[model samples]
Target: MGHQQTVSTTFTSAVGERIGASLALVDAELARRYPGDPGTRQPVHTVYVPADAFDAATVRSWGEGALAALDRHAPDAASFAAVLGIPDRLAGPVYDRVRAKLRREPVEDLRIDFEDGYGLRPDAEEDAAAARAAQLVARACAEGTAPPWTGIRMKCMEAAVRDRGVRTLDVFLTGLLEAGGLPEGLVLTLPKVSYPEQVAAMVHLAEEFEKARGLDGGRIRFEVQIETTQSILGADGRATVARLIEAGQGRVTSLHYGTFDYSAACGVSAAHQSADHPAADHAKAVMQVAAAGTGVRLCDGSTNVLPVGPRERVHAAWRLHHGLVRRALARAYYQGWDMHPGQLPTRYAAVYAFYREGLEEAAGRLAAYAGGGGGAVLDEPATARALSGYLLRGLDCGALDAEEVAALTGLDRAALDRLAGRTAPQD
Candidate 1:
């Protein structure tokens, strides 16, 4: 028995040493990934610009301006991707304006009406513009010089999938796909989504597109726009929302809350509803909880109706309010989405704060544990709890991986053996 105990401890100690060496090496490699300094995290925001907001020169300026602001504020972000949503009619001219200036991938969302018959095929002008936008997207993806994330947002309807059913949607998506419409890294945004079946239908179309092109249709992603009356009231307070999400496992990439449409659906006056209102918080919480640790990013809805201007107060407060909304989502542990160029600084700030808090926490716990001395039995339940919490936070945020726990906290891999109430401090 004594010999076995000796062998086991020796093995664990040797393995812990190797793990520490490996972690040190990985830290060096992670530095190369620009994992950012101590005060940094990924600031991902979905950028939205109104169709009428900018002309050609104005559009280029906006794209460039967003880049500059992101660079200035959230330099540590892994990447930035935008979603441009507007009527199909305006996309071409808008694309012409912003295409040259954007450094990162900018997605395009075609505001289509699926409720109408056979889907509204655009008139000549709109068709031409959509075609041009499509061409631009293909050019960007195929050529060496285009943006990193090229995508599309098509429409969805309950009548088609529910009462009238999704046959109409199938036809519309087929046309979009056939027209050389879908782009690489394409994101199909489903508005008025009520169930997983709707998502399944979209996924089916993506597979068809893939087979046709000999590409991995499985790569197509969905961003559920939890808009419309159905999604907000929890689709008539259904008990199966969690099931709906599970059914959509392969399809969903993120969840987006549309406050304007959501408010209208819920029939609350605009005055009574704010983005951070308890109601909105409840709605967003449902999504954040649903998406937590599932790898699907959660995007908060837009603040809506902000003026692009020189005044710092309006922009400042706007950023601050949105930052609060974002922090709420972060506290719930969602990584990112939805911001204008001016709000870029807040996006970075929130992410930085998120990691900074964790890093500070981990450093504190490690220090205390080290000071406790090897084999120390001091049991301040409160301070001991902090060590477990620190380990979890680091694991959650990717600061310290699972293997590092053995070395850092001296915890073993088995359940119930976690070093929660005990530790062996370094000499």
Candidate 2:
């Protein structure tokens, strides 16, 4: 019989206790600042319409316009695929889905813009528009015709327009409250944020609004538009975007990249200013890093290249927009801005094709990991989380069917949610 060998322990439980106590503040900070994903359906794109131009028929008009563009430009699947260079395998399905999506839900997120899109307007005119916007949005919500997410982009917190911005927001909110309560999908955007103090002010403004309205403290969430270079890199040389997130006080739902403004701030020439410019990429890279694990999403800027004019010109523009969108998806920036109704077709096409092309492989990898079976690709827990998230997003955007995902992965929504770390941990 062999004698059992015993291993001696070097450290006592007190050592671990000491280490844990020393890092208590760090633990708390991590929990507070990096709370992880919120497990909600993030819209795939934000369509901006000038507040003065938006009305009850705006959404339906956009859909009709996009569909009309499709009918006139690429009436058939083959032609549409050829225009956008979609592979033969995915051309038909992607085309069909794009048309259906345009008809069913063309605009995922609609923003009634009072900022750049609206430009500078007279005070009375702007106030009336703001109040009218609220009434229209409330009516849409009540009629069940509102998009899944709908909101307004008020003027920035700049000193010149600060008071106007505040009054507009107050008027908008008050009008909503008077018309009815705030809609469930309501969002507010603060653009041209150049300092952390501005974000803090926004938080205070939201708090004051909530208190006055007798609403919950954290009820109002908004997106911070990273337009100026100062918003990305501060005078102190730190990552200003990260500081801005901290200043948001848990009310920042997303950080929206401003393509033209950011590029112009970087001094890119007008001819070369585009979403895929190196400067834009660098800014977005910093944004992605800072927003990681913060439960805050990142939105890529839009391309100004609208698909219109002659057939060849429209095709060229569609290809450009499609390529940029695909590139954005590959970089994990799932949401972007659509400036025109004509861009909607290419947007949905790119999104659907991207998810569909990778669906089989992603499903297989996830299924293997979930089933605890060895596969060609040995994925870690982190990769498993990403795989599940990709599938969930695909499902959310109507790119992938839940039934098909279940059939392939043998894991339903609940199982996928658990794997994606979207469910709260059980003690």
Candidate 3:
């Protein structure tokens, strides 16, 4: 055999940078666009009420009221299970936890809707409604009954309705600021975005408001609704979600999927429009991948089937809503739109059950992964992040206590906190 020289591999930082430089740039961009960990108290559901019907005092009691409905309709875990079609063994814990959570923090996020929920009124009446919403928000703030997350969703900014949408937003913000400073955790939601220009325009409006109102430059953060096909697909034929988030210029904090509108845009029949429909699922999956690891929050669409009819019919509606919520939970989309107060108990029931079922297993796997111990379960960095987030969310929602988490994972409170990246005490 002829002698052949062996090739040697050499290590060099310059070579490494040259080979992976685009990745560095990509990482930097991702970091810049990423929103960071969501708040510990992120609401499992955002309840929407027509802006005109918003009442500060009554709004505070909506959660309890939802609980009351549950009490009347399905007082025990067995009855709740019967309504949701889940085994009592599965429903029991969720039922108990949901009741407690409703008592503790019935509503986490609320949107006083000025769009679909509040149909277009005369210009003057719309402005008055805006003022009323601001007044209610101010009262909620002062009385300490406001949810940790609350916002207003104005009309869509399409050509025909653009002016009305802008006016509503301007009027609402002006009233909110003049009444009392902006409520804590306030965000604005812009619905039915069809183009990046709409997002840019909204961001510009927010900037102007911040400057004119003497608010912080980025204080007027908003969420874009991915309701239209155009919002999901960019002009260049790529996912528009990241572009939408990018266009917000850090003023965008979340993206909400509007189930009915999105399904309708896909040409699905009105009767078939639903949260778990294939079209809706595809949209949300695209959103998940596009916004993954980016700080921008993702919310699933609403189940419009309200549990409010005759007894049997109401129970049927509740079952439908519960299935939708459970489907969303299985897909790891925690936040969703709850159109009616009657949906709250089922929402929490589904969410709590999802977490409770996975809690012990997730905690063990996370501990083993974090500790680098040999275990049957393996975890990627993303999985680890998700695990930490899962437990922290449970803690925030009152579903899991620090002691319970520590005990389950064999990690102390300090370890759990560090995993959750909690540098400061959670509010």
Instruction: Identify the candidate with maximal TM-score.
Output: 2
**Candidate 2, pairs of clashing residues:** none
Supply the global lDDT for candidate 3.
0.82
Candidate 1, which ten residues in sequence have the lowest lDDT sum?
Answer: 34-43
Report the CA-based lDDT of candidate 2 relative to the real structure. 0.94
lDDT, candidate 2, residue 215? 99
Better model by lDDT, 2 or 3? Answer: 2
Question: Where does model 3 exceed 4 Å of error?
Answer: 1-9, 12-27, 35-40, 412-414, 420-425
- Of the candidates numbered 1 and 3, which has the greater lDDT value? 3
* Per-candidate TM-score against the hidden true structure: 0.57, 0.97, 0.91
After TM-score superposition, the amount by which residue 67's alpha carbon in candidate 2 deviates from its true location, in angstroms, is 0.7
Error of 2 at 287 (Å): 0.4
Off by over 4 Å in 1: 1-43, 50-60, 66-123, 142-147, 159-184, 232-237, 305-307, 310-316, 333-339, 353-358, 363-427
Model 3 C-alpha lDDT per residue in residues 1-427, reported as the tens digit of each score: 7999898888878888787875888878766866466444566878888887888655547777888888889998898887777666677777888888777778888899999889978999999988888888887888787888878999988888889989989988888788878876897899999888889999889888888878888888899999999887866788788778778887777789999889998999989999888888889998888777566778888977888877797798888888888888778787899887788888887777777777888899888988898588778877777788888877777667788788878886557667765454566
lDDT scores in order:
0.48, 0.94, 0.82
Task: Give the best candidate by lDDT.
Answer: 2
Better of 1 and 2 by lDDT: 2
